[model samples]
Target: MITAPITLSQALDRVARERPQAQAFVAPGERHDWRAMREQSQRIARALHAAGVRHGDHVGVLLGNSGVWVQIFYACAMLGAVTVPVNTRFKTEELEFCLKQSNVKVLLTADIFLGIDFLELLTQVEPALASAGGLPGERLPCLRQVVVLGERCPAGAQAWDAFLAAGDAVDDAQLQACIEAVAPDDVLLIQYTSGTTSFPKGVMLTHANMLTNAWAVAQRIGVSADDRYFSIRPYFHVAGTTLSILVSLMTGCCLLTLPKFDVADALQMLDAERCTLTSGNDTIFLMLMGHPDFDRSRIHLRGGWAAAGPQVMQKIRDVMGVPGMCNAYGQSEASPNITLSSFDDPFSLRAAGWALPHPGMQVRIVDPGTGSPVPVGEAGEIQARGWSVMKGYYNMPEATARALGADGWLSTGDLGEMDADGRMRMVGRLKDMFRVGGENVAPAEVEEVLHAHPAVRMAQVVGVPDARLGEVPAAFVLLKDGQDSTAAELTAWCKSRCANYKVPRYVAVVDSFENIGMTGSSKVQKNKLRAHAVALFGLEQPA
Candidate 1:
């Protein structure tokens, strides 16, 4: 009964036809209706084609959450050109790797956005872009052109106005031909996963994969055209693009986006837009509640969409006065949506980290050691096979093979168990587990106990190398404002709550986890945390 659009191009066209005058998206100082957006996308696609971007070509979009960013994404889809979302936080070396790996042909970028000048970075990455006769780099042989999304473009890059005008040379009929040529199974996006332990892998996802996932998520969250969806996360992240942005598009909701996440800025947008639903994690919600400007009277917040524990979700709903909560849990590889939670569900039926799999998705739990399904109510590695699953990792065949089993199931790596009611509860990732002596320890179990403490705001625990025990848990606690608690006191508190092996051997109360590295999705890079812990403790780790 639920028939979503087959491709991004088709979806945009359908929406534009049905609701041409409806508000599509709004940002800090810009707004676009469906008709305008569709026309803009068509013009951009024609310009890209004139610039020699053909089908299956990779077009890198290097910027924040702006109208131009969304325009370029749909433009690429119209031309059947793959959109390679380049992370703004990536350094020169990481940028080099992404460009070389993706073999991007065209780059649609901005001169400056989010306090970062992408044009400056592009010049540094490819110096020829600043000089006459921009030549391809030895490393990036496939890249042909760089389109800057502002005035005063660099030597090798085309200006935003000029690029738009270039489309005038091509007729609308020619652009329509390109749009009609695209297929649903064609790869539309290649999102690089946030690699915590190893190098990031580009996950190839088709329009079908994204559309289906967004449809299920939108339906479960009860999204509608009447709702104003708040998008706080970055456009580069899966949560931002597929979950929040595309979900809004699928449901015909007005997407209110911000370039960056600031407590004040978010509050202002929510108040101005009267946002009915907000999309973010626990960190964003906690900051919103704690901000000095936080006044419930000004903002009409009806609900929030986020992934967190039951206590936090309840706090987000009942305590924070943002009821009609929404929940989602999945990595980028599953077209990023595997499970969902509805706000209408009663608290008695809702357990922490439990989200019912979508009817279109097939979820299974199997023992890590054996390829057999575990008994119901028992924990095991979570696997998924369904419409939402990704095609595979782009240009990484062996990595793809390792993730997708021969049995047609994608090994999700996370450990979880299924309840009698058929809901899945993720316990912890297998890689996140550490052995304290001969006993195994899951950081989540310890972190859960720490979260229960009155003073502790949030916690991230990791395994640090120990000479005697081989590995012991190290805790990083972020306490609430005006709350006081010592590392010794927290350790004692955790000791009283959890098992000996699960208890953290040491605790470090930190000011900013951002001083350590973080993934684009706001997840703590535990590998970096472990290395930092080792250096802090003056301890050696296994190479």
Candidate 2:
């Protein structure tokens, strides 16, 4: 049974008391038990406090999926500090924006990643930080300290190990007492949105919010201690941290963490670890299916978690070796998950699963034109209300008011349908739908047919203005490494599978997509693609 406070540190203490020797996390050659995790968390908590971190203070984490990240997260929970995990993929300018916006006082990062010197990036951004109004004499004013995670600490940074060693062994009783003081409603983490439109908005989540979502997901998926979880999603994402780490911790399951996502490496890890549960976006699933050694019989589980088109789900199960897979629909504002398919519901494997145990969470499909609830089974805007909803966007009251209604429902900005069983079938984004010759066209429906093509690797659809039709659907396609297809050929292929009006009138083939940082979960930055499409094919004139 869950208890009050709902703090991560409290949960870890419970697990330590119940199952001290259980393997909590497994990395390359390192392993940690519940007892060790608790101890490390305490030590890190003492170090953070000694560094002057206080309740409600924001600490930034810019490291990868090392055990240290987990320790830092739990340590913050113990110290009542809020953690702001920045994506390591961010450029110097992007990092500067988040650092300033979050008002971060301390930064924990590695010296390098994939051979790129992060210290060099920090140096380049130092002047920008000063221009942004950092304090005098401090390289980064709001940033009081920098802890390096890797082999050697850079000249201006402190060593992570040295800081941990500087603190005395924390008293277990005192640590437990501190955990008891945290409230379930206290802001625990701030997950920045992908910022498809403009700058990212920080999604403020509380202990109760995340705990409820994780518990609901575990119940819906039937995850137990017997489940061996393997994940490549960056821990900075809510899916990796809340679902993978918190859920695993609560259920006493074994967690296998991969530093990064590589198709071959992911396949090998799943096989070696005998991973029974995994989750990812459509692109990652497609990449895994293309790997040579992907086989269902090796590590088949109840079902994997995903969020994509139904056709993509089917292909993953039939073509890849994964038979049991499910789709979940959510956003960062809702702690990342609101709906999930049951393992027994075979039909849901093809749809974006049913709403989970957040029975208090209300779902409504409203007509895009009138903002009225649509009839059952008809596609409309998906909105939600309940405990899972975030408190509000950090420091953006106007935007927050617009997103969350006075009655407390969140406008998800997604188009989907609720079936007879209350299951959700996501059609596309509301902004992605366009009208052509007075008929509504959903780009996702069109993209699904295009993805069925043998040579197609991925596809994105948008509407470009046309002189005759007002707006017409256009497709941006990516092909397999050595495969090729002409615009006419792909258009003809889609014509055979979809309505003529829904078929893309203009097609552009590209080798890869532009990098747009994702939210905690791996949802695409659709706004970026929309802008790119406008530039590539002039929105003012038809091709």
Candidate 3:
């Protein structure tokens, strides 16, 4: 096996040298081979250097999933500059917060995507973009340059063509010096957390932290140069940048993606490209397999990884025909994966919702309250210590101190149990777990029972306030198309399968959580669901 690259730029160089003609990226209307990818990234790196971005500087990328996004990331890596991927779904306030908090110097963005005018949004945040040289504003003092990657470039921003042309004068020797100076320990990505409960914190991940984790994930899933990977993960999140993009690059596979996820479009691409590997959470898999256009025979899926429960894993293998699909668990701070089931593992073991920690990564479940190790088979907060842990949260010392301990263990804030066989089974997030009177209740256990029902397609459980019991499970469910089920019936279904306290006291059938509770990374935001449930049921809000 090839040794892992110390830096992302080195990874790109190695892949280009080894497989110059191999396909590296494919999106709608665009494609790049390994050699072309590296060259384009180097050109962009020169342009960025010409624009006054230097080592240790933060460059914010606000674009959709496209080749430009990948090029910008590699360009930043080549210069030892950190890439801060702003969520495309960000509103005015969110965009402003990310820019100011990260101290971004150069901003690369699309003019408009999905009908959201980012240039207009930036103007709203600073209001200076309306005039000449709009940047270097009072609101965003560090921001000096704005490069727009579309037809309409505002007065303060340079067009994509102009930005690339600026690099023509930069000599190869100067660019090579910058690339040579980049080390494994330099900060590569500042991935902001999803901010489910609070404001997002920028997780500072070094080149070594991300590249090493991607190499490990690729090995576990048995990825190779012959495979084509279809991933629906948004590029702004760590799941997209590290697991999907980096994994595909390291293995010399084509990374296929869509700017915006459409069920029909995704299905068509899978069949057209004959994609071999794919990755997603339960919701994405449900949408794909549950779609009216789903036909497993045409799509040549071999294997991939899923951050899902047993129900979803089983369906992906049996119904979706991805037998090599493995169960996975992690958060953004651990470069996104702490445990993953190997591709060659038996279906029974893979479907059991247990994931083995990657080699060199140490995982220990400890009591959330006491920090004491829990016995095997007992559930507790999962803590991981290894090279994969992020350096720290950028500019948030208190948050960093809370997340990373002095001894090197990074507290994941997730709960799980380790079996005697050393495989870990995720119970639920500690914040997501609620107490019913006195007994602890995991929402996943109840959701699993709900998933077993024939009519249910997807479900999310949250605790709502109760005067007598202190808290009780309230479930939001989406039913299968052409099927019918009521809230009372589903609650009764769960009552029969789950313990008394584990059963949801109420169930609300919803058509979708896309607008209400889903995050950019496709995770169900339970805090939002919990708030919605409290308001929907007229229950007293938790203090």
- Evaluation by TM-score, superior candidate among 1 and 3: 3
Candidate 2 residue lDDT tens string, 330-349: 87888878777765566544
- Candidate order, lDDT descending: 3, 1, 2
lDDT of 3 by residue, 1-543 (tens): 235449898889989999999899999999899999999999999999999888999999999999989999999999999999999888898889999999999999999999999999998887766678577889899999889998888787788899899998898999999999999999999998898887899999999888889999999999999999999899999999999999987788999999988989999999998899999888899889778899989769988889888887888878888879988889999999999999998888788778788888899999999999999999899999988899999999999999999999999989999999899878788888899999899898888888878788888999999999999999999888888999889988987888999989988999899867678888789999998999899999656
How does residue 248 of candidate 2 score in lDDT? 81
Better of 1 and 3 by lDDT: 3
TM-score of 2: 0.91
Error of 3 at 235 (Å): 0.8
Pick out the ten consecutive residues of candidate 2 with the lowest summed lDDT: 128-137
Give TM-scores for every candidate, taking all chains together and pairing residue i with residue i.
0.96, 0.91, 0.98
Ranking the candidates on TM-score from highest down gives 3, 1, 2
Residue 430, model 3: lDDT of 88
Given candidate 3, what's the lDDT at residue 93? Answer: 84
**Best model number under TM-score:** 3
Model 1 bad stretches (over 4 Å): none
Q: Candidate 3: which stretches are off by over 4 Å?
A: 1-5
lDDT of 3 at 249: 77
Q: Which TM-score value belongs to model 3? A: 0.98
Better of 1 and 2 by lDDT: 1
